[model samples]
Target: MGAAFRARTPSLAQLFDEDMLGDDLEAWLNESFLLKRTFRTCAVIAGLIDQRHPGKEKTGRQVTVSADLIYDVLRMHEPDHILLEATRHDAATGLLDIGRLGSMLKRIKGHITHRRLDRISPLAVPVMLEIGRESVHGEAHDFLLTEAADELIIEAMGIGHTAGE
Candidate 1:
């Protein structure tokens, strides 16, 4: 007789980390396949991100965000509930709204926190664009880019880096 066999399973973190996975719902399902330890890791990361960013607002190309609170909230919940809250639109220009972007960030952070990982700090503006890129493009991208450009102008003025090259 053939020997009995069990299929190897994947973890929630791995699934979410996969480039193709669309959102949190997909990641949660991925968790079912993971070993206990992996699941814990996933949850920790989600929690940390959540604790770090709390209130999120759309502010041109990048959303005005608070990292600490977001990390804490994520540690307490599952992804299913969070993804359900995100509205799907054209991948291009879909997540441009700061309100929506903030919510999504919260969800992502929440996912990390639940897994019990430390929150990432020194939150860079580029990080926000990268995270939301999958859902934004075209005019939306332009809008964000323009906003970033304007901010650079204001920031540059404050620092005074003259062009003399």
Candidate 2:
């Protein structure tokens, strides 16, 4: 028998370790949210995590779904991100119940049209929203795209009304 060697398998926490991301991840998240209130909420939550953990690992399986990061980056004060993440995770795992996501997608489609931004061509929005929704269901991937979608609609509406004025 040749020398025995075991393939190293990184733990779930290892994959999303905070050391690998540093402040950049925080910065990116902040910029992604952009709105002063949203940014502040995210920042406060992140700071709380840092304070509570002190020297412990700040990423991994916990952070991926169960930690404050989820609230900071996705859930926070809304359920849209939670729903979207759940949908995405289900899709990635091949365990997605198409009928369920189809219904959610239908809801998303209604929102998109309501924003009047459908004219801008929203090909990827549905897919991303589905995935984002899946993430909240403890499926793979981090961060849902729901917040971005809302921001896009808010911005689009702002522009639409301004143009009319």
Candidate 3:
């Protein structure tokens, strides 16, 4: 937690209530797809995607694979896979790091002094606006990446044709 990183944003700060502790925090996190996203991200870092393969331009019988399918297979077959565990350990954001965050959560949950806010809060307007913004930007970014990948694939084919090897 660097002082420079602290921009005094109340968005995340306001979500915390004194009554709600670690178990609540874990529950809150479970609702998000952060685990799956982290797994994919770590998969790339772990060299599982294989974006680089020499002479890929002339590869024959190439088969396209959907990321969702791979994730489904891994999840169903090996729930406690190294990739998923690596996500918890090596993820840049450390959102699911069970070591430090889990310990802090245990300490927080130990204090069973009073009841808590069982339901969620009412920050509907801002959340929707942020989500809308993210959706637009995410779609645009994804399109740009797709375009770049298509260009690479076409260029690779051209190389194969011209070289005739």
Best-performing candidate as measured by TM-score: 3
Residue-wise C-alpha lDDT for candidate 3, range 66-122, written one tens digit per residue: 444566678689858887667656543465565655466555553533223445346
Ranking by TM-score: 3, 2, 1
Please give the lDDT score for candidate 3. 0.56
lDDT of 2 at 164: 100
RMSD of each: 21.1, 22.5, 16.3
Residue pairs clashing, model 3: none
lDDT leader: 3
Q: 38-81 in candidate 2: lDDT tens per residue?
A: 33344445553233356776555543333344444564566465
TM-score of each: 0.16, 0.17, 0.37
- Residue-pair clash count for candidate 3: 0
- How far out, in Å, is residue 13 in model 1? 43
